[model samples]
Target: MVKEIERAGIPVVHVCTVVPISLTVGANRIVPAVAIPHPLGNPALGKEDEKALRKQLVLKALKALETEVQEQTVFDK
Candidate 1:
């Protein structure tokens, strides 16, 4: 799907929790989130904690949209 979108000359951004897997799948524009089930928030955590985590990871994902790179990338702390 991502490749197809890019092939159509449309810019693509893949926000994912799994970094290595996305690269294996040939994802060019990828952002590494925290976990697989909840990319934005963890249900087990308190509301405040979940919000903070989502905010941090979402910021990383947004930053990725602005940056340019040659190879596959993963945003990690």
Candidate 2:
């Protein structure tokens, strides 16, 4: 689906816990997720902290989208 969306000229940033899978699937923009259960938030953290972390991850993904890349790129937080 990611590839198909990009094929249609819409860029996608895939936030996932599995980096290898994202790479294998040819996701042009990839963001490292916190974990499988909670891809954007860590339950161990306080609610506000978790929200902040999620926001940070989303910001990183947005930055990745703005970046120019010749090949698949993974943005780490």
Candidate 3:
């Protein structure tokens, strides 16, 4: 699906916990996520903190979409 979107000139940044699966499936831009069940948030965190974390992850994914890459890239920073 990610490749299909990119094939249509739409860039995709896949945000998920399973980095290897993302790579195996040929996701060009990937963001390492928090967990399998909740890829963007941590339940142990306070509500505000969880929201902040999710926002940060989203920002990272957006940044990845803006960048060009020749191979699978992990935007874990």
Better of 2 and 3 by TM-score: 2
The whole-model C-alpha lDDT of candidate 2 against the native structure comes to 0.94
lDDT of 3 by residue, 1-77 (tens): 88898789888999989999999988899999999999999999999999999999999999998898998899988
* Candidate 1 local lDDT, 1-77, one digit each (tens): 87788679776668787777888887777877667887778899999999998888777777776788677666564
Who is ahead in TM-score, 1 or 3?
A: 3
Off by over 4 Å in 3: none
Best by lDDT: 2
- Alpha-carbon deviation at 9 in model 3, angstroms: 1.3
Give the lowest summed-lDDT range of ten residues in model 2. 68-77
Separately for all candidates shown, the number of backbone clashes (residues 3 or more apart, or on different chains) is 0, 0, 0
Clashing pairs in 1: none
Highest TM-score model number: 2
Against the reference, the lDDT scores of all candidates come to 0.76, 0.94, 0.92
Candidate 2: misplaced stretches above 4 Å?
A: none
Can you write out model 2's per-residue Cα lDDT over 1-77, one digit (the tens) per residue?
88999999998999999999999998999999999999999999999999999999999999999999899988874
Candidate order by TM-score, decreasing, is: 2, 3, 1
Q: Per-residue error at 23 for model 3, in Å? A: 0.6
TM-score of each: 0.77, 0.96, 0.94
Error of 1 at 20 (Å): 2.1
